[model samples]
Target: MAKITYIEHNGTEHVVEVANGMTVMEGARDNSIPGIEADCGGACACSTCHVYVHPDWVDRLPGKDSMEEDMLDFAYEPDTQRSRLTCQLKVTDALDGLVVQLPEKQI
Candidate 1:
């Protein structure tokens, strides 16, 4: 499992243990972390699960695909370098201590 940290716009922090093979969005949803709405469940059909990966982890995580990149265009104030769709991030041991910051609002 990986220990992931989800930070809300107001600075609220939620640290949870996510099993390998689960998506980052699933980790937040299962833990009832409020910042990630995950409107489409684990499917990358919406941008409600958008987050800004901590700069320190931007490269450590997997690269975004065309689909995730397209969905991010609909996210709230997306950052070219840090923005990502949580549903697209599969958890692994390498993601231990991953930190993601939620946007003020999701579009």
Candidate 2:
């Protein structure tokens, strides 16, 4: 299992144990992490699951695909370097202590 830590805009953190092969969005949704609406589920069709990858761990994640890139363009605060659709990040042992910072708002 991978341990995913979600830090809300106000700095509150929610830690969830995610099974390998599951997306971050799924983990957040399953754990009821308040900020990750994930309206489009894990389809990469919405920016509701937008999150900022902790700068130190960015390189550990995979590069975004075109679809995720397009969706991110509509994010509330698209960060060229750290912004990502959580739906696109799958949990893995390599991401055991993955920490994602939530945006102030999802709109």
Candidate 3:
């Protein structure tokens, strides 16, 4: 399992353990972390689960696919380098201690 930190725009932080193979969005939804609405339920069809990967972990995570990139366009104030759709990120041992900050709002 990986321990991921989800930080809200208002500075709240939720750190939870996510099982391997589960999407990051699932981790937030299951743990009841606010800010990640996940309207599509980890289907990669919506931007409600968007977050900005902490700069320190930016290069550490996997690259985004076309679907994730497209979905991010609908996120609120997406940052080209850091914005990502949580549903597209799968948990793994390598992602342990990963940190992501929620946008001010999800569009």
Candidate 4:
């Protein structure tokens, strides 16, 4: 399992242990972490799972694919560098202490 932290726009923090192979969005939903809507259920078809990966770990994550980049165009307050869809981030030992910041809204 990997321990991941989800910080809301209001500064609320939720730390949870996610099983390896599960998506970050699944971790949030399973643990009831607020701010991750995941409307498309990790299908990469929606942007409701948008988040800002802490700069410290950004370089450690895999680069986004073209589909995710296109979907991000619909994210709220999107940040090309930090913004990412939680559904695209798979939990792994390498990301044990990953921290992601939630946006104010997900429409």
Candidate 5:
């Protein structure tokens, strides 16, 4: 399992232990973290799961794919460098302490 932290725009924090192989979006949803909407599930077809990966960990994550980049154009408050769709981030042993901050809004 990996321990992931989800910080809301309001500074609320949710730390969860997520199974490896699950998406970050799934971890938040399963743990009842309020900020991740994940409207399209993990399909990468929507931007409701947008998050800002902590700067310290950004370089550790896999680069975003073209499809995720295109979808992020629809995110509520986009940040070209830090923005990511949580659904695109898979939990793994190597990402045990990943931290992601939620936007002020999803829709």
Candidate 6:
């Protein structure tokens, strides 16, 4: 398992143990991390699972696809380089210490 940290807007942190194959959103949702709502359950249909990848980890995740990019346009707080739909970030051993900063709100 790898450790994934979910940081709240107020700077509070929640760390979760993520299995190799699960996505970052899954790790948060399963562990009851408060920031990621994951309203579409990883389906890429909802932008409620929006998160900001730590600046250092931005290059670590895969580039967004058309569908995910389109959905992000509807995200509550969107950013071109930092914001991401966590549901698409699959966990990996290389991401053992992945940290994500949450936006203030997710509509």
Model 5 spans with C-alpha error above 4 angstroms: none
Candidate 1 wrong stretches, greater than 4 Å: none
- Candidate 3 deviant stretches above 4 angstroms: none
Candidate 2 per-residue C-alpha lDDT over 20-85 given as tens digits, one digit per residue, 9 for 90 to 100: 999999999888899989988788888999999999887888998899999999999889989999
* Model 3 steric clash pairs: none
Q: Which lDDT tens digits does candidate 4 get at residues 17-65?
A: 9999999999999999988999988999999999999999889999999
Model 3: residue 73 alpha-carbon error in angstroms: 1.0
Mind sharing the TM-score for model 2?
Answer: 0.97
The sequence of per-residue lDDT tens digits that candidate 1 reaches over residues 1-107 is 99999999999999999999999999999999998999899689999999999999998988999999999999999999999999999999999999999999999
lDDT ranking from best to worst?
4, 1, 5, 3, 2, 6
Per-residue lDDT tens digits of candidate 3, residues 34-63? 999999988889999999999999898889
Q: What overall lDDT goes with each candidate model?
A: 0.95, 0.91, 0.93, 0.95, 0.93, 0.91
Q: What is the TM-score of each candidate against the true structure?
A: 0.98, 0.97, 0.97, 0.98, 0.97, 0.96
The Cα error of candidate 1 at residue 94, in Å, is 0.2
Better of 3 and 6 by TM-score: 3
Ten-residue stretch with the least lDDT total in model 6: 30-39
The weakest ten consecutive residues by lDDT in model 5 span: 33-42
What's model 5's overall lDDT? 0.93
Q: What is the lDDT of residue 52 in candidate 4?
A: 96
lDDT of 5 by residue, 30-71 (tens): 999997889888899999999999999989999999999999
Better of 4 and 5 by TM-score: 4
Clash number by candidate, in order: 0, 0, 0, 0, 0, 0
Clashing pairs in 5: none
Q: Which parts of model 6 are misplaced by more than 4 Å?
A: none
